[model samples]
Target: MTDTILEVRDLRTSFFTENFEVKAVDGVNFSVPKGKTLGVVGESGSGKSITSLSILRLIQNPGKVVGGQVLFKGEDLLEKSEAQMRKIRGNKISMIFQEPMTSLNPVYTVGQQIGEAFQIHEKLNKKESIKRSVRC
Candidate 1:
């Protein structure tokens, strides 16, 4: 059996404004197997970013996920509470922003920033986190 790591089903997200509503994402679906890579590609404004944001439950005010199921390891992320999602983000799943300059902190080195995840999720010390960060 192919081990399915992540699956997205019928995701729908919309932005609400006083004037009108914009359907940013609608009826998106995909699956990623374990130890595999999935790339999202589309023209600009084709709901690529919106679909990703909806999967991560990162849609902010004026925008909402209308429908969908985001399953990670067979667990429904769309049903998870905010606190639960916090534990999953970065630890279980992560997104590399398209622009590194904006995503990365100016003061910290790349290793320090990457190692921070190990410190938080794996409970490793600064020394160990830095050590592990460089190995990859």
Candidate 2:
């Protein structure tokens, strides 16, 4: 059987605005075993994306992972330094942003934007990945 590659325990992410606090992700727990895939499904604003952002330590200003732990290969990612996280971010771990178009450059075609993404994790050249993306 495959071992647990990633586990999240009681993850809570919060956003603070002038008016009040929004608990985007609260008390979330899950695990992904090696050689396995997990799917998270819920209605909009149900904190699905927020939980992922927290696990990746990509929570931005006004939003923070207030509590809980993200364990990757038995190492607590929450305890890792930013430099350590940086190394892990591109190599050991990665993410696919939810919206493709929002960040796509207006002048570039969708294939061009997606090709850059393949360059990131898949290590394909712009020409090859762009061709692959366009075909898809």
Candidate 3:
């Protein structure tokens, strides 16, 4: 095997309302090997974003991942606690929102935002993170 980095099996997500439920993502399945990328393409509102959100466990109120497993490096992310997920997110994995304008804080420089990741994930001091960000 080439070493599977991520595997999503029977992934499902839904939005619940008072009267009905919208199956945003239903039975999605795929795998990506290490050093590979998976591109999900579809029409707008075809569950692409929902699938990504569910994988990251970012689904909020009214939206739930009702089923399936998101395996990252052979571990089930769905079974991880919220605190665990917090560490995994931004460190092990992240979502780059489609909207660039709203994704970052305009007040801060791009380098500052980028360095924050290193600070949080790698436990680097602010000075070290800034240096690393500059090199990138």
Candidate 4:
């Protein structure tokens, strides 16, 4: 089996701002092998977030994944439907944002928020999810 867990080739993302089209990710390429981490380091407006959003197919209106092949586990994620992509997003591939405080909901308790991940991905019962979360 191939060692690559995720591969992004010639990935491109663009946004239309009234005046012109801005290419956030311009033909970027990288691969992450299994059991390894890939760090994207750059200044703001460097297309780091856009690249992740495209991988997740989470780009909003006026912004689009113009071109790319995002292969996860040998599957072409870019070619998958939204519903199909959703299944892979939090389950097969998970991401922790740079700022956990902002990523989390302030109103909910930490346990409650963490339990939601189990509920969504594992479909675990609330009690069991909470128990599992506490162990973490």
Candidate 5:
């Protein structure tokens, strides 16, 4: 069998609100093979964002990834250290938000922001980085 690139098994995420506990992701399970994509389609508040955030371990206080395993290339992502996950977050797996204006920093030039990606992952020098960033 082909190896699984990403596996999320029985994932559960919850938020402790002032009055009650809100279950954002309830026992969600899926696997994506290499070079494949999984589109999660749901209405707002259907746990789409929470599920993605949980995969990256970015869910903050009040909401937490309470259960399940996030395996990337057969490794348990939930068990990875923050530093390790930081390396993976953008390098191995990159996310582009729906709103580009908001995603980019107004203070920084577009080239600067894009160059940061190459700098972090590929360790490109400034001149070459800007060139590649512009191409991106």
Candidate 6:
């Protein structure tokens, strides 16, 4: 079996504004092998975050993945349907934003929010998810 866990080939993501287009990620490529890690370091606006977002298919509207493929365990994530992506996200593939607290809803407790993620990704009941979240 191959030790390659992820392979991003010629990924290109862009944003279309009314006046112009911004190519956040143009032909980016890399891979993460089993028992290995990869870190991206660059100046701000160098498409670091955008690359991660694209890999997860989380690019917001106005920004889209224009080309290339993200192979995770030999499956092309770019070709997966939204429903399929939903199942893979947070379960098989996960990401942590730079400032994660900003991603959380202030109205919800941190545990509760994490519990929701656990419930959605693991198909655990609310009570069980909440319990698991608390333990973490």
Which structure among the candidates has the greatest TM-score?
Answer: 3
14-123: candidate 2 lDDT, tens digit per residue: 99999998989989999999989999999998988888888889899899889999999989999999988877884677687777677457898867876765677678
**Where does model 6 exceed 4 Å of error?**
134-136
Candidate 6 achieves a global lDDT of: 0.91
Ranking by lDDT: 3, 6, 1, 5, 4, 2
Worst 10 residues of 1 by lDDT: 90-99
How high is the CA lDDT of each candidate model?
0.90, 0.85, 0.93, 0.88, 0.89, 0.91
Sorted by TM-score (best first), the order is 3, 1, 4, 6, 5, 2
Rate residue 4 of model 4 by lDDT. 97
Q: lDDT (0-100) at residue 59 of candidate 6?
A: 97
Model 4 over residues 48-105: C-alpha lDDT tens digits? 9889988889899899999979999988898998899778876787766667789988
Cα lDDT for residue 70, candidate 2: 98
Per-candidate TM equals: 0.92, 0.77, 0.94, 0.90, 0.88, 0.89
Candidate 4 clashing pairs?
none
Which parts of model 1 have CA positions greater than 4 angstroms off? none
Best by lDDT: 3
Q: For candidate 1, give the lDDT.
A: 0.90
Please give, for residues 1-136, the per-residue lDDT of candidate 3 as tens digits. 5599999999999999999999999999999999988898999999999999999999998999999999999999999999999899888898888887998899998888889989998999988999999997
TM-score of 2: 0.77
How many steric overlaps are in each model, in order? 0, 0, 0, 0, 0, 0
Looking at model 4, residue 14 earns an lDDT score of 95
**Colliding pairs, model 1:** none
Candidate 3 deviant stretches above 4 angstroms? none
Give candidate 6's TM-score: 0.89
Candidate 4: where are CA atoms >4 Å away? Answer: 98-102
Please list all clashing residue pairs in model 3, or write none if there are none: none
How accurate locally is residue 108 in candidate 4, as Cα lDDT from 0 to 100?
Answer: 84
Kindly report which residue stretches of model 5 are placed more than 4 angstroms away from their true locations once superposed: none
